[model samples]
Target: MEIVNSAKEIQEYLQNTRRELHENPEISNKESKTSEIILRELEKFGNFNIRKNVNGNGIIAELIGAKEGKTIALRADMDALQIEEETGVSFESKNKGVMHACGHDNHMTMVLGAAYLLSKRKDELSGKVRFIFQPAEELSPNGGAKGMIKEGALDGVDAIFSMHVWPDLPLGKVGIKEGPLMAASDHFTVTIKGKPSHAAKPNEGIDALVTGAQYVTAVQTIVSRN
Candidate 1:
């Protein structure tokens, strides 16, 4: 992999994008405004095929190289959390009760920065680069990645690359791993039905709250022991 030498330029560009995104935070599956901003930025670079509304506000921009080679994909999610912005930054979120606390704004900015750099050097590149701006990543049941994949986002792609901004790690430093870099998250919900009884009743019906407490404790042990 060829590394770009313009780290300072890239960081500045990413910071501007991140602040803009942070100010206009949008929730999952509702990133119309965010998508428009990304589209506009991508258009300015030139030589990019922009496909909007790929999977509910998701965008895919393709940059074909002069020479034929493998096609690699870079993904960045663009969704905000429901929590209110607590950071007293000057560019705080304008939307009420929504924030980019998970660094998704940073992720989007990084991908867009890379896209900007790569688009300028398209002729020097060997393979195609697909820039994916995905939405609804924080959504449950099904995420934006799954929706994009269902709509053939990964078609003809050889490898996928993604990264998250880690504040814990030192700035300008990158941490990489070969395998099992992150754990796969799996969520399961169990609902128990029981008859409601009066508070004074001793043994009238099965208590659901009691069972739920026990179930939660038991399931936690599974992960703790593993």
Candidate 2:
């Protein structure tokens, strides 16, 4: 696919879309409204095969080119974190205690922007492009990616692409790498089996809280030291 090269020209569209998403953020597994908004906006392009409700509120939109080539996929997550809006901005989250604090709003806006640009030039492209709006990314141990993959989200796709917002980075700056830039994240539970002890007891029983803290501190050594 060729670069659109007019990202700056579409600045206002992107900002308004992102602000709308940020104001009405939805948490994991509850992105029905978000999914609706994405579908509604994607329909404006009027050139794609749109699939909705893929493994619970996931959306897949495809733009097939006139020529024959490989199919590439672009993905975006549509979930917000559990946080209250304290910034007092006008477009702050309407849903109390739920906000797009992790910048998923920007992620969705970017992918939608890409979809718009690609659809505009679908006649000149040489391959297919898939746009995925995934839900439940904030939940671990059973994220929405697993569900989408199980339902064949990546099937028949030659390559995939995704984007994320970095901390305090300049506009249009991109980072590329061959190897994985992030470590694998998974959920873990540590249940220390210790007897209940009194607060002032010197050596009555084991202290689970102190033991957990020590375990955490010990684990930090792996990252802090060589």
Candidate 3:
């Protein structure tokens, strides 16, 4: 009950921070401004031993508890997608051609919210809490997590927890399971070439657009059909 009440007290803080982040979204590998804001907020929290610019705009913040125990980590992604905002919200993305479409703004705010509450309740804790703010999550095969780990983000961590916002879930509800909650992602690139045709010509040249669309439709069903 105490923790719940404390979290409620910071509800406004969480919302405002989330909105601030959403308004100025940055794409993968370009989260400098995002890292600055996170650093500022963590500094205001005042108990974390923060390491900035870890593996390109990543942040690792550690908070020691009152007693000696294990270390735990909480992670949040810090990259936005290359998308334009059409949500029409008052605090929609201000950076053109980039948007927090993946809810990373929310994820960062949630981690900061946890940091805020934990900062105030350090006396009750027995272990250390590490907060990891990683960038370039949208870039696969070479995401920021690899660099963060190389920078010792998990040097002394016993366990780590991270979560994402799911639009499929009901409002104010959280879903969790024992095993993995998200599926692995794979990236691929395909290029199709076609001869150029005059605008007035009906069928003189091959239609690469149609070929690409057909390929996309066929590829989309690979997993389901297999």
Candidate 4:
């Protein structure tokens, strides 16, 4: 039952897991394979009830502590971006035009690592732990968070802990924020209209490219000024 012995051993073990996920990154709302692997791996740890396909490819797992205190949750997002990987790594993304550039693969691995660690120390645990593998964290206006919450992802959870890996924060170091740790995420699209004309034409059509450029610049200042 010992997948790894010490910290170094677990590090290497999780590295391989992360790499496997990174090489096969799946986009939002399309994480069937990723969920399959995660479900398969989590079952090996034992002592938990696992459920899948919650409002998409989300996985919910519950680990009951030996003693009683409060039910806490740990969550991870398992969605990738629609970007092609040019890193040329050996385990580069297999899904072309979709990559784990946002480090969601790392996020999934970290939660799984926590699951393993807590499983080892479950006897000393004073509460329950829920491992939530969520999908579509990047999709705004219709994110998986709302769907999962609607499906009772936090029905009886006292608190939840999740993290994103930051390069500025060195390994073994953690950063904490008070008040608001995240900004409101919103998405919008603007279509600038211009009369079609030949490339060499002058004064024959409005320059939508310039208009859009100005619009982008104007919106960017909202963050700084506010």
Off by over 4 Å in 3: 189-217
List the global CA lDDT of all models: 0.89, 0.90, 0.94, 0.89
TM-score winner between 1 and 4, please give it: 1
lDDT (Cα, tens digit) per residue for candidate 2, span 143-210: 89989988888999999998788876787698778978745678888789877767788499888878
TM-score of each: 0.90, 0.90, 0.87, 0.86
Query: Candidate 1 at 97: error in angstroms?
Result: 0.5
Worst 10 residues of 1 by lDDT: 1-10
- Residue 212's lDDT within candidate 4 is 90
**lDDT comparing candidate 1 with the true structure:** 0.89
lDDT of 1 by residue, 3-26 (tens): 556656577767787899899989
TM-score, cand. 1: 0.90
CA lDDT, candidate 4, residue 154: 94
Q: Which candidate model has the greater TM-score, 2 or 3?
A: 2
RMSD of each candidate relative to the true structure:
2.3, 2.4, 3.6, 3.7
Please rank every candidate by lDDT, starting with the best.
Answer: 3, 2, 4, 1
Error of 2 at 83 (Å): 0.9
Highest lDDT against the true fold, candidate = 3
